[model samples]
Target: MTSPFDPTPLPPPECPAHASGGAPEPEVSEIGPGGLRRLYGPAHEKDPMGLYEKLRAEHGPVAPVLLNGDVPAWLVLGHSENLHMTRTPSLYSRDSRRWRMLQDGSLDMTNPLAPIFAYQPVCVFADGAEHERQRGAVTDSIARIDHRGVRRFINRFSNRLVNDFCESGQADLVSQFAEHLPMMVMCQIIGMPEEYDEELVQAAREMLKGSEKAIAANEHVMGALYRLVARRRAEPEEDFATWLVEHPAQFTDDEAAHHLRLVLIAAYETTANLIANVLRMVLTDPRFRAQLSGGHMTLPEAVEQTLWDEPPFTTILGRWAAGDSELGGQKIKAGDALIVGIAPANVDPVVRPEPSASMQGNRAHLAFSGGPHECPGQDIGRAIADTGVDALLMRLPDIQLSVEEDELRWRSTLMSRHLIELPVSFAPRPPQEITGPVIPERAGAAARDWQISSPRRPDPAASGTVPQPGPVPAAPRTAPPAATVPAQRRGSAPVRAWRTLVTWWRGY
Candidate 1:
């Protein structure tokens, strides 16, 4: 197996000093303690729409602000500027290693943002040919996934989850259903057994909090991937893990582990929030609810609207300046740290004067970052969210929030904007009989040996954060349909990658 970290030559420099062509230096306004508190503190976390609006209106699209009230970074608040920075990767690099704060040891490695900004062996951190290599491998494997099979998997899991609390007449949808459904779908996609679902859920909990426990959480997830890789190598099966192992990239065992870890977590986090946000919209706004049932808005349209208004991810990790540059008339010096403000950029009044009206059918949001480093799993992520939401709506059409809309809470994190819990109530219904073909049991280790010990769990209460629930033990899962794709063809990675992006563009 070849090392997946193979480096590629850098592209010719597209940005140079004085690239702004004598534009006056824009005052880099620091986001003082009040600003930081307002952005990631409790008030902003609850509903960032107002904060983003204030920032964009007061500071223009691109403004400089202190991260955590100390770390200086530029927040790209406009849609056009966000697109310019991300689309021009040569000008703005994704390589976190290039971040001057990390190099100078000013940034603490233990900082909660480390997981996203710190260097990792996977493609998300890589650039140039290396990015293409790892990205191609991921996109090619993703493109091979049968679309209908993915929908079936989501439906089965969604149905299984809904049955868990249907008799209770009330449940916290976020903890009980919205959160766990995506994790189960991701596990099924990666060929993990059903039994380890609890452990993975716990790992996700730790990973999101991002402290000392984050270190333990990382190890826990990697350990599971290692064991899964060994099992697949010993007994190859029809799953993403197997395809990754046999792909032309020939990723080494460790390389395979890292990439699989990335895929699982990315797939789980993005889709989970996507499903939750869409459901929240469906439950909160009677107008939106009527639109859905009246055929005025489709599930995909709902998903699209959520992506624009409340993208799963609010910010992308720091993209450092390779050389001094200017964006939207703001002079960005070399080595300046820039964070893509997804929430603000998506609603920039300049591009989207009326954000709500623009999203009726728009697909031009930066929820998924653009350029060489765009998310490779977006196609299936959308499928998973759409299918899961569709299943819930079809099953529990009368579901409504049990609590007042204002009473719901959102998690406080620098990188994610997730609802902590969405309590909802619905009329009870009798369980349906299992009539589908006898769903086959999963094939993997029988014991719980893969559950690695970790450091002491973080105190969610100490931080005033609510931990999401573990995966509800799913019933026998319906087997997904076989992949409709043929074996890998020559030079197919680029094609597959292109097809996935194009699909995202046209909303096919």
Candidate 2:
């Protein structure tokens, strides 16, 4: 028997002679535990849609599968079935504590995949009245954000990131651009100093990878949030942290911090992946680019299409059977784990008859999930991705993939699929000069209270220079010297290849 984590691709299943002779095939139950397909492994990672189709043919919509430890779970595949499972919270609970494997110690807490499924005291794990309280706090606090101001931040940060690479003529969009833009914008929204953006991004990525470092990385993230919550308590600011702290639910300091961490990580991971996916599509698909350039399709439409086709998260872990119940014709016992197959359901033939056809203008994808636990901050993620992608394209209209599409690679975990690197080449250009205030004036006094810090200008009096009243002349545009560009910004093929290998080996 092959190991679940085996990198070797499995051969396609052959039709039995009995099937050609009109004999009935074996039932899924008779296949036994050992015969169940593993959700991990290189074959699934390379082509998950193929795996989903095979499972659908063999075991119907809710297929029995093994997780990392050969731990049994059900993967819900049908679009409607996924909706049914998520919508009926009474029948299927989000509380991981209710999972039977955890109860029986069959699922080791130290398992690499455990970090993702481990129960925490945040809104994501709560159900019923407790869920309402926590979810309300999160939603209400997010509602207080000025979205127009968010777009401004997205544009400013997007340009700043592009400026870093626009002078190099070659860049890896994944590491250099897509990865950092979301967190930088998020820092402004959460009232954290922009300088801490890199640390937060690193911590969030490490925590989600479910590697050995996940636990320590999670603690590091929580520690940052705890400090932020403490600061907000004394000095209330117009930010998500402050609003969450002031919610009527009156979360304890720890509870507030956990919720803040939840928002930060969720927004960061989804948006970062979304931006990368959209950029990859634009760079690789001539049809997509033509449509956008010709005004036949808009960037938001392209974003929506990517959400349907290549959602950031592939499989989410997961809802548990609240009691003995039936789902997609499967007998789900109390405490049985059921993972939501987000990517599979999106291409489900029942809803998407032509899977290869365009998904433009469709908003029914399970990318952000559905029902009571649906992502409350999905709109914010969309805004960041859409605005950020548009800004990059506007700045580098000639950008194209530096390698063949087939040469591109991805790193897949049970929970998400990530583009490892997206190398692209374009003509080097001068950086755009930003001339306005960082925060829009319409943001009001609350916005002014927590201004994004910037470098202090030298005082004329201290410099012993008298100011001239005439307007300063605009600087002449010139290509930045190659020596001035950062080594990583140059996007050296050998360096990028080594980095990609390290990232893949790390399971990120």
Candidate 3:
């Protein structure tokens, strides 16, 4: 049995073009220095859309680009072209084994991009009947989820996360809220213990960054998934993991584990970034905020607009040419790799002539990609973002960005672009009392007594300033004493701290 992580190259799977003859060499002009552009670098990281515009101007919709390690591939930049590539799976394949570089052994498991493109047993890397089997299991399992229960979990986790910083009057929304909310909710849905979330979050994020640690991070995530699958198999539960294990597809332990890994990382990364992006737009753009708060634009509409303008995933490592074809006036050969330029395609001039115009109610954006391989968990991602953002805003209506818009930083990679921090300030508030089980019983097992750390009380003596009359000062007001939790329920250090803060809040 070969290890999935085996560094040894395997023989390229045979394709129609390979049987007819060898794939044609790309035209010299197209492969030349002037024709090819590298897709990862400071230039691209700083201004990917600007760089996409230049590439579109020079190379039309299907531009030749080099990924990390100077590996060559094509980037599909036109909206129509992107749809054509993804929709016509007969002409393009999702299987990375068909990739020319992978076939020739020029690309290997060690490449930073390998974490994305390396072949896995999961549906994302399958095609034909195999794809249908794996994808059906995922879709069926996802469809079984109770969305209302999902929203409850989202609300509960959102409140808990906000409580960690509400009393401080200042917090980094990225670190404190956006990053943790999605995974925490997902843990409940997937039947994983909440204690594993912090480690999973760190590993999932590191895996997507295409860094030297990406492979290791990916293994860590998979190892955890394997353990979860084993537990579920031994004693099944009514959660996503158990569903996959018992699906009619009869997935092996390895297959079930890989698919769980797929759903977890994909959902966590996309939703986390979506939450961050939506919040950033609300804080930075007064007009956008007015529309939402004024009831002119719904939160879902704002999320849609963000998807079009700044998708969570800027690019997805992507379809391989099934045979010779032409797209966006560029000739493609069998086995040529083509990345889906999601963000660029959403703004393609052909479909969206005025990129600045609103994208309300338009679900055509490729933010979630399209075709048979489109994201199965997109609705879940949207639900998490919408419910989480709405909860935060409702709890902290006075929230405002603590730093200037220009000062906010972003981390970009081949697959994603996300905020590094979203520092914000708001009137200090007390923690919401958890009156009932945060996790509804129907949402799997009864809620665990997970404890969260108490937020720091602002130091009034350190400020030493005269109070302003127009608005409340940054210093937190004295909170009331919190009720004590039963000793048996005081689970973790964080929760112990939270109880102390809650007790203090009750005295205010």
Model 1, range 43-134, lDDT digits (tens) per residue?
46656667666666666787655554245677888888998899888889988888766666666554436667878877888888888878
Candidate 2 lDDT, tens digit per residue, 1-508?
Answer: 1122212222222424113235664432312346878777666678777888889988778888877645678999999999999999999999999987777665555455777788999888989999998998888777766554466557667888888889989999999888998788777787665335676778888887765567788888888888888888887765778777866677999899888888888988999899999989877776676665444566788899999988989889999888988788888888888999999999998999998789878899999999899999998999899878866775776777899999999988888899999999988999987534454343334233223222222353566432222222232333321222222223233434433432232222
Of 2 and 3, the candidate ranking higher by TM-score: 2
Off by over 4 Å in 1: 1-39, 437-439, 442-508
Best by TM-score: 2
Model 1, position 285, has a per-residue lDDT of 67
Candidate 2 matches the true fold with a TM-score of 0.81
| Best-to-worst TM-score order | 2, 3, 1
- Please give the lDDT score for candidate 3: 0.75
lDDT of 1 at 312: 92
lDDT of 3 by residue, 1-508 (tens): 1111122232233533123246763322212243466787677778788888988998789888877655678899999999998999989999989987677775666565676887888899888999998998899778767664456557667888888889999999998899899888887788775435577778777777655566788888778788889988887665778777867777999999888888988898999999999999888876576665444676778888999988999999999999988888888888888999999999899899999988888999999999999999999999889878866876776788898999989887888888999998888989886444655453234323221112221233555431221221122233422334322223343445544543342222
